[model samples]
Target chain A: MFQKTLTLVLVGVLFMGIATLTYGTFYDKGFAASVTGMMGLGDDEHGEDGDDD
Target chain B: MTKLRLPKAFELLLVWHGLLVGSYTIAYLTAEGAPVLHQFAGYSVLGLLAVRLTAALIAGVRPPWALPLPKASMWKNFGRKLAAGHFSALLGRTPFAPLSGLVILGTLVLVTLSGLAADWWEWEDLHEGLAESSLAVVLIHIAIVSFAPLLKRLNASRADAAATALPRNA
Candidate 1:
């Protein structure tokens, strides 16, 4: 049961990481910005406040 | 060693569950700081929920894909076991699992819907409140799922200890 739970958690983290990376790439924000921006800590470089529209 | 294989339906369910966990975690983590990521995650959650509901409808509300509604009979059986001091009976599936799942599902729906409404209306506060409160439900769900396995392991270890101790006492 523990192993199953752990596997599920790892799979979730993998999906999340990939999705974040994809979002960054799609928006041309690069990896670091995409991550930090997603966390709301990145500085705006495209005149966007990084706020949810 | 044999390869660990799961049924197609089970695999799909695992993937769905994994995605839901990922999306929800991302949504919750980005809620206060990252608006873009938060929105992305929130929309992902909304999409996932839609899929789950649709699947439940199509599957005719069967186990492993159905809405986790705890039946009255389940509660009654669980209560009877507890009343009889049958702790081991609670080591496996229990009524609380479905109950927690039902609560989490309902709470998530409210949170997601309110978030969607907040995009145009003044439902931001309501959404935030529901999201915050939903964390508790999520945590409780986790606890309920984990509790059974944990207790089973504990009981096994205690039994092993007793078995070993019998030789020393003898």
Candidate 2:
């Protein structure tokens, strides 16, 4: 059961990481903002591109 | 012959990906003026990494990739393993085992994330830091992989010698 759970979690992380990367390549600003938010740096004044208006 | 040998297909993929990453690293280190090409190479490396990771994960039983994922209870036993020096044992288990793989995968993820953000936000700090970390990890990874074959041969020879030194049962 633990093995299954670990596998499931890793699989999810792998897929999610790939998906975010692919999406980020095309929509740079949104991807940057989302990743920054995920990193808890969304409140930083330096976060995100200036184009994020 | 229990020595490690990646499948021909996987080997080909590894070689191709290595070349791409090598080219990108070269550009990253020397051609700071060519941001366009550098960025292109970074993205290409990211794409290949994604493909390789996905393939490794999806391919089941036959010719197992031998990815040693951390047990779900790893945190509970982390201190014990550390105290017992099991970390080294874990790393030496296989050519592409979990600990090494986790570093490679995690570094690539960081590089990709920081690279994208660097390009988008015009901030090079995080990207540069992660790129340097990736370079160090990748170099160590290469050294280990290149030594694997020799290590296997040495072990095999030692085993053969030990067997020959034993008295014949028959």
Best by lDDT: 1
> Per-residue CA lDDT of candidate 2, range B1-170, in tens?
68986657544544544444554453353224334334555676677677766766786433334334545456446556767976643334343434565687778877787888886696588787777777788777656554545566787899998898786753
Badly placed stretches (over 4 Å) of model 2 are: A1-53, B1-8, B60-98, B151-170
Candidate 1: where is the Cα deviation over 4 Å?
A: A37-53, B1-6, B165-170
- Interface RMSD of candidate 1, in Å, is 3.3
What docking grade applies to model 2?
incorrect
DockQ of 2: 0.03
For model 2, the interface Cα RMSD in angstroms equals 14.5
Q: lDDT tens digits, residues B118-138, model 1? A: 889989889989999999999
Clashing pairs in 1: none
CAPRI grade of model 1: acceptable
